[model samples]
Target: MATSGPVLLVSQAQQRKSRTYTPSPWGDFFLHHVPCTPSQLLSMKERAKVKEQQVRQIIHETIASSDLLHVFEKFRDESGAIVSGDDASCLLMLHDAAHARTHGEEILDGIVAWSKSRLQSLVVQKNLLEPELAEEVRCALETPRFRRVKRVEARRYIPVYEKKSTRDETILEFAKLDYNISQAIYCDELKELTIMVELHFWMLGVIHDPYCSRIMIVKIFVFISLFDDLMDNYSTTEESNVFTAAMERWDEQMAQQLPAGLKALLVRIFNATNKIEEELKLQGNMHAELIKKMVINSAKFYHAEVKWRDEHFVPTSLEEHLQKSIPTSACMQMANLALVSLGNVTTREDVEWVFTFPKIIRGACIVGRIANDIVSHEREQASSDHVASTVQTCMKQYNVTIKEANEKLRAVIEEAWMDIVQDSLEQERPRALLDIAINVARVADFMYKREDAYTLSFVIKDIIASMYIYSV
Candidate 1:
């Protein structure tokens, strides 16, 4: 039921009043936009594809050569061959070679076993390896690249690629530039987002990896954040009702009575929706109607919250708050937006599964909503104007102290994650789609684990620096 497209900003008076809110230390740097044109996006995509092909070719050639196999064979015959267990470079080669789809018959099964045994011996002996190589060995042992998060794998391999003397300098340079460009685009979108809604783009880029995918994530969250602020702080009961009706109607003619800011926001949302629809159409998807329905449903939920606040009413029980919170959280809408970048890989059936509110998706929404409330409840209560957060509702319903309520909510968050993992195993859906749901919860944990990191940027400065300023 959550909405999509660009979000509308709060009234100018409300914005001025909220200026007392703490701003990020990196505000100045983040605000300076570095525009990335369509051509640049296309070029980066092409470069990434070409680099991937080159890496594949290099792996294929290394596997075909018998030099590494001969070394392994020599060690296999000796009682104590002194094979360097810290040879991650060699281990990586073996891992990829064993998994190669099309390869000349060189018999890699024995080599894989021999290499794995030595690696295990190194682990048993607690042998010291360079930190980078040590982590690589641990990851290879624990989770193969195929099952690992793509961004983590990319970050880990970039350093390995740089260490090789035969590595193509030009490709490495291009990769570095591509990364910087991506960071810049993220910053530009984030700056515009922060003007109305306090949020971060770090986790989105990490999970999505691709440039276009990251952009879509930023767009979706930006709108969600702004809409949340409007419902929570800016709109009155009458204004909220009028706005909701206009959104449900979804026509320019219905927007005439809206305030200036709401009018502008509606126009922006429609523009963004149109743009997304065109892109999806080009990709042979018919998602415009579904997205429109989602936006309208989200507005209806927003109106419900406004009515509750206006009537000075609190939910009678915790379950009541959850029923409303699930749709209002907007996690499902965000998940669908992320999937748009996946193109034909996501089938119509996959989209239907998302809409059905399966356990994995429901668990993610619960985590996102409760985690945010756990950290931000006191701050929201201080305002005395916001709708009842889950933390407060639980305290009132159970007649417990704030500390006790938070402890129970924390337990609920943990249980939700367990449900997500269990459901992921049982479901037959695409792993990529499931990962999107998991990543939403992960991002929520990152944003609110210590405090309301999304609202106060200082808490997440180090994370932002590592993701943007420093390269792997």
Candidate 2:
């Protein structure tokens, strides 16, 4: 049968509408609309570039004004050194804007090439400062520089926590994952990834505050992610296979190719996750521990559920098993991490009090992600005899379907956000940039399909927010 003109027009209109409404993390971070195809995306790049130029022109014109020049000098002493890295990065942003505007579709690719050179140069220049430090950095760089960069020689895993790599395989994996999930997601584009790394430098520049230099912040993210994965196994369904593939790609192949530093950094992330688990178990946070334990347990449940379905071994109803599996411990486990992350509030009571807020956020994340997975695999779910949190089962229990769950999840997330605001205000914390960044991550997470995004953001934001508020 031949397709009609009206159908084609309608299809085009829907596609356009979808692009506009997509909750993309990259779009949110860059403050632009999500792109649908390579061609459309190239067009968006040109548009972004043009806008960047306009921004640069405004900044240049402002700097040229006498008042601004005077203020810049006044802010510095007589033997004033050059502007700091923070300022340099800001200037780079302006430059990026101009390039984006001027270069059109070439802006992203050009910027990426430029950044790789810049990173290499930065490493070379650092070598000039101290040969020993530079050599150590180079060695580590040969390891795991994707999520982290090389730091001074420390035999023990020093949690380097940078950002992901920008290689083809990594990009392709992220793109495929995002597409398969049918949700707005963010992957580390070359520019964004560079900016994320530069952010570490920016913090060190503006506030040579020792805490800013500590390993605590990076470790927190790693721990929170592991904890989230443990607790939210149900939300994963078929989507887990995609992530598993990505991990396998990293371990089997990508790990072999990265700089020594990057490879070590990836190894450190896993070590850190295990360490956190040990510490939590020692502290007797049973709820959190159980979540980790249950990933393996849930798999067993699926196996048993399948056997029951096949042989009709009616030991207990599937509903009973499901209910038993979802322990009330999740709320408490989430609360523990949230309080710990909020730097200023460390005691048991402080953590206990904040537990309520984390629970709400956890629920939102689980429900939102689980619903998304079901929607994406609606047909697969129909065919599977036994699957965790499938749409059919979800509808049976809640009297609502996937879309309804997403809406409800959104409302829950909003409510928990207010609690976060209230907690910060009550604690009288200073809303530092780190805290704000954590909150931004939390908000940006809604644009992604990762179940961990919500849980990680909650812990990150709560911790940073509490640090500002509690002053500990």
Candidate 3:
């Protein structure tokens, strides 16, 4: 569990008592989540498998079909086919460009560029569309489907599609059924799905990739979450530094000097990390060195932040802060580790590409780093031992209002999304690998979009219920 997001801080024992963490809003409710009955579980799993086969068939058909990716190559207002023709032609071009762009095909980039430009103008055209249609056009222009997480987009599109004049009853019916079954599978995985669990699901489910890695990822997350709290709210800097050394040494004996809780945590982490390595080896991945290095490095980053807190250091600039914080997100490590569970679909080259922090990995990390900071900064700043967060540092460096600093961070997230899109078009990386990296960012954005839904579990209690408690 490599800690990510803003590091929590606590003062020394001499100055003041160590801080304590806020309890989970759900409290002991987590202890009582009942698994679905066996019959219900079988039904949902069977339905999901059927849908999986249908999706595979569709993908085969798509790859085997004739290429229409270039059908709108010359479509433009001046070409006398898009704008000069009837409104149907304009609509057709818009749909075609949108379709290709969403699929990550760069073959129609020129057409997409022109189509988007014209669509932006047409969004304001009063006579061409009804008021409702105009609003849809604007919304589509502002937040295209490619920019959304698939699960989020599905839940959102239900009402919109229900209102459409030509909506297919069969498609809508299947969508509702599919949503419920997927939610069941998600909920069945754990008591409640936190943001990292959501991230683990999406990283694997986006392309229907192997899920053998999820067990490792989620276990690591729980361990790291506990360790992060202990380091940030309870332990002295001396204890954290020793625990970090113990991590690097990979020895239980090295942690003997620490308190009982920390020693137990270190042992659990060592066991969890080793279990991951062993399980992955059985899957034909022998990257123990890489996996061990990631765990060690994660501890190092956590220790560094603790040092910053103990010294009362405020980063002078936002870049300086990100230089340390982004790595703390562990996006690169998570992406690399996930490749192992993919079995053979991914290559060593893909793992190396991530290790180098290519544009896609860096972009994904930034999205997670900045989005987490945005929601947690205010609560973090309230602490006397506040370690400088992205929001706080931005306000200090740019001398802007809190709202303005937030706006700036949101803009940065948008740019990171662009980088994800741009890298996908390159197609140099494996598509499976690309989805793993891209969806890391998407999960972060979804979790932190409106509030700290991850931390303030109450905010997403309904969503959790929708996935776990109710049937569609």
Each candidate structure's TM-score, on Cα atoms with residue i matched to residue i, is 0.65, 0.28, 0.75
Number of clashing residue pairs in every model? 0, 32, 0
- Candidate 1, 192-293: lDDT as tens digits: 554322344544532555345455545555656666777766665556667778778777666677778878887787778667667668767655456666
Candidate 2 lDDT over 294-404, as tens digits, reads: 232333333333333334232233245334322221322322343343444344444443333343333333433343443444533443332344334444556676677
Residues 1-472, model 3: lDDT tens digits: 2443223223334433365443445444433555456687667667666666666666688689968664554454554444333353355336544532433444454445555676667766668876656666665665555555666567656767888888766466566667765555555455544434433444433333323436555666555555555556667777777888888888889878877877888888888788877877776775544667777777777677887777777677878988887777667666766765566677766666787788888888898788888998888777766567888778888999889999998877766776777777786878778887877776666667677666666666675555445655
Clashes in candidate 2: how many?
A: 32
lDDT of each: 0.66, 0.35, 0.66
> What's the CA error at residue 116 for candidate 1, in Å?
29
The ten-residue window of minimal lDDT in model 1 covers 1-10
Error of 1 at 376 (Å): 0.4
Q: Give candidates' CA RMSD values in order.
A: 10.7, 23.7, 6.7
Give the Å shift of residue 329 in candidate 3: 2.4
| Worst 10-residue lDDT window, candidate 3 | 3-12
List candidate 3 segments past 4 Å from native.
1-11, 15-22, 25-76, 79-143, 158-165, 169-178, 191-213
